[model samples]
Target: MIKTAFALSFALSTCMVLPALGAEQFQCPLPSNPNDPAKLEQIRGLLPDVNTMKNIERLNATIATLRRDGVSKSLMIDHLVGAYCLMVVREAPLTEAEKAALVRRFTGQVTRLVYSLESGLDIIINVPLTPDVVDAVNSVAEKQGLSGPAWIAMTIDDALQQQRTTSPPELPAGFSSSC
Candidate 1:
């Protein structure tokens, strides 16, 4: 009985130790002082060669600022780290699908970018769209008998109305409204 107990303890201890030993050496650091150049340089060194080091640095700074602006969640920090790393190293902007995925991951909603216009004002907001999207929007606008901008405005208004009719806002899982 003693021998069996010893074996079980040993197995459990080894399982715990192995994970610690196999853990990654370099983690994306979220140090208290993000502006520290020395620490930033150390993280920069861990990355593979990429042409957009400045972009990475800028993204890091932006993340740090965001965290300081009261967004403190480990999952969000990790997501931002992964997203920025992939974005900079890949040397390409995230595709529309990728952006949607990121937004869903972070926000827990399948939402489009919504803009608000002030009531009783004739204002124009310039939203640049990809060529393909522009073509699609133009087609839809023509079919709806509205200008492209008017179609977009109507769509946004409809979405807003739908949200208001819902009992409560559906937020992302694990989302803290404070952030």
Candidate 2:
């Protein structure tokens, strides 16, 4: 009986340790092209680590700024999509369907690029938009249209505020919000 208990405890400990051992190391997959060093630097600076939710919020804010500055939707989407693809390629091996889902999931940012050849041609050819993209679409969909970028930023801020208020955490001071 004691031996069985020890074996169970050892199994439980191994299971807990496995996930921590497998946690991915995040790296920005910014392009190396020097033709537009500033743009590349900005992209690199903006890329998020896997562990940080703040990076996602920061991307939304940046999109808001770009929209305010009158950057075209297509242009912004193109750059963001490219960056997203690079990130996916760098992080993990995904099936094409998974890649499309990732694009759908993080449309404002193309978080994954390389996908399995088996999923479909669309995943290969199409660029997926992030939530920011959804914001852009919604903006254009409106008759008097709120600016897409502004809409995205506001939406993200509201969501973050909501998250903070609804589920207060146990640690990290200043993490809570009244919103």
Q: What's the TM-score of every candidate structure?
A: 0.28, 0.34
Local distance difference test values of all predictions, in order: 0.41, 0.42
lDDT score, residue 111, model 1?
13
Clashing residue pairs for model 1: none
What 10-residue stretch in candidate 2 is worst by lDDT? 109-118
> What lDDT tens digits, residue by residue, belong to model 1 across residues 10-121?
4322221111334442222233345555534443454333332335555445445544655333223333434334434343464444433342232211011112232468
lDDT of 2 by residue, 77-146 (tens): 4455445555654546664445444533453232111111213553322436667756544543231123
Per-residue lDDT, model 2, residue 105, is 45
Off by over 4 Å in 1: 1-120, 167-179
Q: Please list all clashing residue pairs in model 2, or write none if there are none.
A: 84-110, 88-112, 107-129, 107-130, 108-129, 108-130
- Residue 76, model 1: lDDT of 30
The local lDDT score (0 to 100) that residue 93 gets in candidate 1 is: 60
